[model samples]
Target: MPRFMGFVRMEEGIGMPPQSLFDAMDVYIGEQAAKGVFLDGGGLYGTEDAVNFVVRGGEVSRVDGPYAEGKEVVGGWSIMQFDSLEDAVAEQEKFAQLHAEHWPEVTVVATLRQISDGPEAPGD
Candidate 1:
């Protein structure tokens, strides 16, 4: 199985919602966990909590990000192992739909990154 990292893009100005809504979402995530497909997932604070960095003139400068201009920012992420890209995409679609219903204006990009084994460590 291939591992996937799911980035969740979220809408603007959606401060905390009612407690019940969070509870419902918790249940949904719990269901995923029960299925053994869920590796990890969590939400994030807003853009203010972000930081961006750039390098120039042999110096490193820092700025707040996920790059400001975008309509949606990566609010959180999840890691999962799936059999194929199609399976990962299906999960992304499911998450996108849920995000749409909760935050209609948000846009999402679910990317797939491959992890390969590197050189062995000194021990074994």
Candidate 2:
């Protein structure tokens, strides 16, 4: 089975959602977990609490937020294993629909990407 990452992009300056919305999300996530589709996931804090690192040449530098260029930030992410890309996409659609129906007031964009397996080992 291949793994996919589903992420949520949130527009800058959006406030926390209402408790009712959180409740709905909990139910949806629970269902996914019960179905064994959800492997791991978590939400991130706002850009205000974020730190950006840059490595150029042989030097490393760090920039502290809130970053002005960050108009959109990743709000959350989930890792799921599926038999195919189509299956992963179908699962993501369910999450998108939940947000559309329950968190209409919140600006969120959900996206999915397949996780690469990386290079093979020298000795297998």
Candidate 3:
């Protein structure tokens, strides 16, 4: 089975939503988990808590966040396993729909990406 990561990106200045929103999200996530398709998921703190490391030549430098130029940052993520990309996408659609119905006032963008298996082993 192939694995996929579904992530949410939010624009700058977006803060934590209301308790009702969180409750609704929890119910949706719980339902998905019960189906045995959702592997794991969690939300992240604000971007101010992030750090970026850059390497140039032989020196390494660290850039602290509160990234002013960043238009959006990952807010949360979910990992799931599916038989194919289409199946993964269909699952994501359900998540998106939940957001659409529960948080219609807020703009949320969810994206999905397949997880790579890394380098293959030597010939069998």
Candidate 4:
């Protein structure tokens, strides 16, 4: 089986999602976990207190958020396993649909990418 990483990105200061969205997500995630398609996943806090190390030239520096730069940031992520790429994509689509149906007032971008365990093949 292959594992893919899914990320949900949105504006950082948009506040919390509606309760209905969380309720719907609980049911959906529970079903996925029962089927073993959902490996591990959870929502993330905003970057207000986040810390990062950056390298500039030959020096390293520490940066703190709310850095006041980007409007969009990753708000959540999940690691999921499926038998094939198609299956993983299908699952992600359903996940995105949940946001569409329940959090219609917010703009959410769900991104999916395979976790590469080795070097890519030619041209890939």
Candidate 5:
């Protein structure tokens, strides 16, 4: 099975989505979990306190502000295991629809990839 990382971007100053919407999402996640499809999920805070890290001249620099140059920021994400990309897409579409209704301008991204287990040997 493959895993998907789904991100939900939220509109600026809109606050969190309604509880009912979150409840629906939670229900879907719970159902998936019951069937062993859910790996992990979580909600992120507003980007106001975010700090972006950059490496310059072999040194690290931290910059304040949301890294995205958009009206919305990723307010949350979920990682789920699925049989294929199709399954992940189907699941993500539901969230997309809900988000569209709640945050019309927000972007939704779902990237699917195979989960990799670290090599047994060091630096393998």
Candidate 6:
């Protein structure tokens, strides 16, 4: 089985999803959890209090968030394991559809990436 992380990205100041979407997601996530496909997941607060430590040329610098230039941010994420990529894609489609049906006014990107198993890549 392969494990993948899926997350949704939205505009920086976009508010939270509506209660109807929340209720619908609960049911969807519950079903996946019951099948042991969902591992762990949750929503994150906005970047208002976020901090980043950047390193360059052997020096570390801190950057505080509520970033004025950042146009998008991750809103929620899920870690899941599935028998195959196809299965995962199918599930992701359902997740995205829920947003399209419930929160039709806002645009969001549902991204899925397979978790790396070897080693971390060097950053530039």
TM-score of decoy 6: 0.91
Off by over 4 Å in 1: 17-21, 64-70, 103-124
What digit string (tens of lDDT, one per residue) describes model 3 on residues 44-117? 88888799998999899999998999888888998988877888889788888877877787788999988778
Candidate with maximal TM-score: 4
For model 6, residues 1-124, the per-residue Cα lDDT tens digits are 7888999998977677899999999999999999999999999899999999999999999999988887878889999999888899999999999999999999899999888776764110
lDDT of 1 by residue, 57-123 (tens): 9999998755557677766788777777777778777766565565454355555444444564312
TM-score of each: 0.68, 0.86, 0.85, 0.92, 0.74, 0.91
Q: Candidate 2 on 1-24: residue-level lDDT in tens? A: 787899999897778877776888
In candidate 4, what are the lDDT values of residues 5-121, reduced to their tens digit? 999999888888999999999999999999999999998988988998999898999999986888889999999989888888888999999999998989999999998878974
| Residue pairs that clash (backbone atoms under 3 angstroms), model 3 | none
lDDT for 17 in candidate 2 is: 70
Give lDDT: candidate 3, residue 61: 98
**Whole-model lDDT values for every prediction:** 0.66, 0.84, 0.83, 0.90, 0.70, 0.91
Which stretches of model 2 miss by more than 4 angstroms?
Answer: 120-124
| Model 5 C-alpha lDDT per residue in residues 1-124, reported as the tens digit of each score | 5666777665656655667677777787788899988889888877778888999999998988755676767667777887777777787777677666755654555444445556443212
Instruction: Note the residue pairs that clash in candidate 5.
Output: none
- Hey, what RMSD does candidate 3 come out at? 3.4
Full candidate order by TM-score, most accurate first: 4, 6, 2, 3, 5, 1
In terms of TM-score, how similar is model 2 to the real structure?
A: 0.86
Candidate rank order under lDDT = 6, 4, 2, 3, 5, 1
lDDT of 5 at 36: 85
TM-score of 5: 0.74
Error of 5 at 9 (Å): 1.6
TM-score (C-alpha, index-matched) for candidate 3 = 0.85
lDDT of 3 at 83: 77
